[model samples]
Target: MTVEYAPGRLADLYGEPSRPTVLLWHGTQTDSRAAVRVLAESIAELGVGVIAADWDSHAADHGRADLLASVRFAQRTTAGAELVLVGWSLGGVTAAGLTLHAHAFGVTIAHTVCLGGAFMAEDPITGGPVLADIPASAFRAPFTLLVGTADDVIPVGAAEDFAAGLRRHDWPVEIVEVVADHGSIAGARYDAATDRYEPDDSAGTAVTARAVATHIVAVARHA
Candidate 1:
């Protein structure tokens, strides 16, 4: 079921509260909880709690305030639990920013996963450099990047560059290439009639979800 952890911050929660929690963030121009609900459910099925929040990345504050609020909410609701941050598309960049600056917020992030993330360009909302320029010393946890081989939205080169940057600083990082696109990797499809998201049921979509869930569980084990 879904719960509101803060005003304007909602999460589609799955699994027991005691399980390790993944705070999932959505891409640009989408509601976080609804956009990634299916993928979150898939991860939750692996015996972890998935909490996807809603934030407007284009808001005046560049979604930073809301995203931080979501993190704080996750910390409060899932105290004593391992916390992993998962972000898709632009949200992935936001997650990276949060991880680099987590010390400022006094939060501990066990791990991070970015699916089809775009981290090379300047954040139009925040008007700052992206994750590619973050120093390795800034990261407080291990990170995984899930790139879609068929994704045309964000070039694979960007992912490679970000991974290289992290490796240069001797950070623990992994980049997994999946046979899916930007949307299918996260099991998202827009429904015109309902104006909401619908799940993608293709074989490729299943493979992508399973691969991502496996990585999340694996990372949590070592976190």
Candidate 2:
């Protein structure tokens, strides 16, 4: 599909952007500026470039719109370069939707990673829809999903079920379990000294941005 260009947004390029880049999508309720800055800074330590897209927070209401715009923005900005899309929480769902859209439009994703992805809709037994609705062919690229063992908000079982759904579609899926809580997924830590949340050195450390960056690069390398 042809990407309609939208101009005037900032893209945080790290490492040798001349190389393929990774696009970071932040979770719902979080803004792109801060989230991208943190993750990009960490991964840049490993010499990688990241293009973090800012979308309407209203996307929580209009998730489909957010997904299309983010993918289109990514497509236009990183044209011809290998791309790895990483999404957290609600953003993870957006990332998965983008993977399908991009594949359909003939764009190549180096890889896709969803962190504490809120992929499952609701408990199917509880009368809510399933979390993952995309087809297998949509996931034309290899993907990884990460969840915390002690995540109180997202049931680890749901994350596993999502992975199983991907496999049923014949999609290559890898699931990683980190030894942390939901806060640890974002690498957010409470500074009892400061009495506020601070960036935990160990936050997201278990699934360190470096590990995510390495996996994405590997996908691009093979592709």
Each model's lDDT: 0.76, 0.60
Residue pairs in collision within model 2:
14-49, 120-131, 121-131, 187-203, 187-204
Error of 2 at 176 (Å): 1.3
Per-model TM against the reference: 0.88, 0.73
Query: How well does candidate 1 match the true structure in TM-score terms?
Result: 0.88
- Residue 114 lDDT in candidate 2: 77
**Weakest 10 consecutive residues, lDDT, candidate 1?**
131-140
Per-residue lDDT for 108-150 in model 2, tens only?
A: 7778777777776532111233334554456468778878777
Backbone clash numbers for all candidates listed: 0, 5
Task: List ranges where model 2 is wrong by over 4 Å.
Answer: 1-11, 59-63, 122-139, 189-223
